[model samples]
Target: MCKFLQHTGLHQCVPSPAGAAEGTPTTHQWMLRASNSVLMLLPAYHNERVFMLAYWILDLGSKKKKKEKKKKKKKKKKKKKKKKKKKKKKKKKKKKKKKKKKKKKKNNNNNNNNNNNNNNNKKEEEEEEEEETLLKIVPTVVCSGG
Candidate 1:
């Protein structure tokens, strides 16, 4: 009997009366029967109730989707920043290489100037030695002829 009532979506709150009394003014039994009848014949709620519930659910889903989109946007921004930094680094390295090449060229020019000065000094020394040898040979020949 209880299972049959439950199958019909009716809950038995309390125990039934002692005897099979019909149409008796039993307040607790009336309340129980009224509750059971209410459970069996469920009334549809207002449209506003369903609309409010659906609005909250949809609102929450959109908020979650927005948050995920923001995270993706942030990740994309980070990747862009990283790529920019890499390009900046490469530009700096190229500039440094150009500066080093310029410095090397300057040093080579200075070395060539120094080599030219040394060659000039060696030519002057050779000229002085030839002048000394000619002076000694001319005097010896003049003394021999006298």
Candidate 2:
């Protein structure tokens, strides 16, 4: 039992099967692997030099999973933000187009008003010219006393 415990920690060692109480070294290793798989417990090393192996087993996989999930979330958020930005830009463009149309309509109205004023001024000038022509054509009659 002490030998077994030395090979596997008391907390981690599993009871040997009655059918395979005495097994070869390879068989024991296989049993340990089966036990670990059934128990869902991955082996860990408490040593310094084997730290890289332990780290590879435990740290990298979980860290990669977490990073991937975070990246997916960030990508989703970026897509949403881009969509919102596009909507806002479309709204701004529509507003700008409306403003430009309104300005054009106002300009057209002002141009019409200016044209009407010009027409009125031209009619007044024509009336003045006619009056001058009539005055020039009319002769003053004078009576002389002898």
Candidate 3:
């Protein structure tokens, strides 16, 4: 066990497999430690540096898995938000189109009403002029007979 593991109060250590030749200088020995523990085989020619490297590699693999999970969650949330925004935009566009159509209808009705009023005024003026001409002709006939 490394000093880092011993200092952290992890004293438990599992021995190497019995299959290896006992007392053979060339054989490898396995050891276990607590912090992100892994079964590490230390060759007789190698040092503690190799064991520490293996431990760090295993720890980094686990950390990468956790990061991938978090990224997936964030992507799901972003998709939901984008869908909601699109729905709101579509509704707003529909409302705007309806308002524009109503305004156009109102303007058309007002123009029709103004045209009708102008036509009625012209008819009234023509009728009054005919009445005036009839009155003038009747007075001229009466004066000539007298």
Candidate 4:
């Protein structure tokens, strides 16, 4: 559930009593993924009842479908503009980072012998510690209607 919200770029969500926030509500309470996307859920909601039909049968009504279509068009325009701005900023930042990295490489080459020895020793110790952790595990229990 956390991963699904993260994928949509939504960092925070309202807590729902029924576990997942995005799916259909069990009662009068519901938690949405984002503040504004609640419109999508309300249209499909049928007097506190969950959809019993298959995926193709559920409809949000014509009014809601039209409103959602408009909202999507506006969102697409805004998203495209934001993406262009981000791409420009990323290119400039990457160029600056490459220059800084080159300067660091030159300085490191001056003390290459000592730095290489210390780095190798540190890596070996870290790998041994990681291996120990990977070998340990905890059992998990699941209950089904019991």
Candidate 5:
């Protein structure tokens, strides 16, 4: 979750099948050979040490999705807060009636909603597994000569 950003987070980095050529990789080649572990790459580190001496800088793909998610959550919370405030401002007398109706509806729907709850749980588990999966790493080659 806190690891790789969406674009570099293996949106389509499917593993290459067995018997596929294990040819030496080139710069930013779109291939996924068998690897022990996928090292998450950051743009800054790519330009850290080396030839060309920062002439070309890799654009970092971080914080873009994180900030979006955070903003979305904050917006949801604010909406909930506004709804709560409106409910509080309503007449106290109607609150009792609404509460009773809500409780009755909740009880009536709980049994029929069991399957939906289970499906949601399964989806969450699958997402967690995806989050655990690592992105394939490509090693950068460097040489020095004139």
Candidate 6:
């Protein structure tokens, strides 16, 4: 009875009432009561009730199906090819030669003498003008005194 209950996926078997024989009308009544409660607690679907009733009747003595183990396939590893490296050639740079510039010499004494002569001539002309102005002023003073 317990095995049947387990297979049906219903409530655990209720021990028979003390001194009550198995398969008795009282035990059947208890089972029916429990089943009725389970059905009422479930969603109201006529088809679901029919299916549950059919499953309970049909799969009573059938064994549970065992899950099959899946086999793993072996993967082949690929070989990596080695790449050859190329050698780079070094380039030589040519050095450029620089040309030297020639410098010319200048005679500075001639330029200095010319500048000094022009300055001396200007000074002499200014001294002569000053003497003429002094002579004219002396004559005017003598006339005023007389």
Task: Highest TM-score: give the candidate number.
Answer: 3
- What CA RMSD would candidate 6 show? 27.5
The Cα local distance difference test for each model comes to 0.63, 0.63, 0.63, 0.58, 0.51, 0.45
| TM-scores for all predictions | 0.36, 0.37, 0.43, 0.30, 0.26, 0.23
The lDDT of model 2 is 0.63
List CA RMSD, all candidates: 16.5, 15.0, 14.1, 33.3, 43.1, 27.5
Candidate 3 lDDT by residue in tens digits, 10-92: 33343434584433221122222323443423333245664666567667768999999999999999999999999999999
lDDT of 1 by residue, 1-146 (tens): 33333544334444545684433424444333454353333343334543354455556667999999999999999999999999999999999999999999999999999999999999999999999998888654344654
Best by lDDT: 1
* Residue-pair clash count for candidate 5: 0
Tell me how far the alpha carbon of residue 24 in candidate 3 is from the true structure, in angstroms, after superposition.
Answer: 24
Lowest-sum lDDT 10-residue window in model 5: 29-38
**Candidate 6 residue pairs that clash:** none
For model 5, how does the per-residue alpha-carbon lDDT over 41-93 read when each residue is reduced to its tens digit? Answer: 43434433321222222212235557788999999999999999988777686
Give residue 50's error in model 2 in angstroms.
8.7
Error of 1 at 125 (Å): 14
How does model 1 fare in lDDT? 0.63
lDDT by residue for model 6 over 1-146, one digit each (tens)?
A: 34444444443345556675653334344345465544453354445544475446334423322111111111111111111111111111111111111111123456567778988898999999999898888664444654
- Once fitted onto the true fold, the runs of candidate 2 whose alpha carbons sit more than 4 angstroms away are 1-55, 109-146
Using alpha carbons, what is the TM-score of model 3? 0.43
Clashing pairs in 5: none
Quote model 1's TM-score.
0.36
Clashes of each: 0, 0, 0, 0, 0, 0
Q: Give a tens-digit lDDT track for model 4, residues 1-146.
A: 33333443443333345565553332222222242343344454553322332121333345578899999999999999999999999999999999999999988887897889899999999999988887785447687796
Off by over 4 Å in 3: 1-47, 113-146
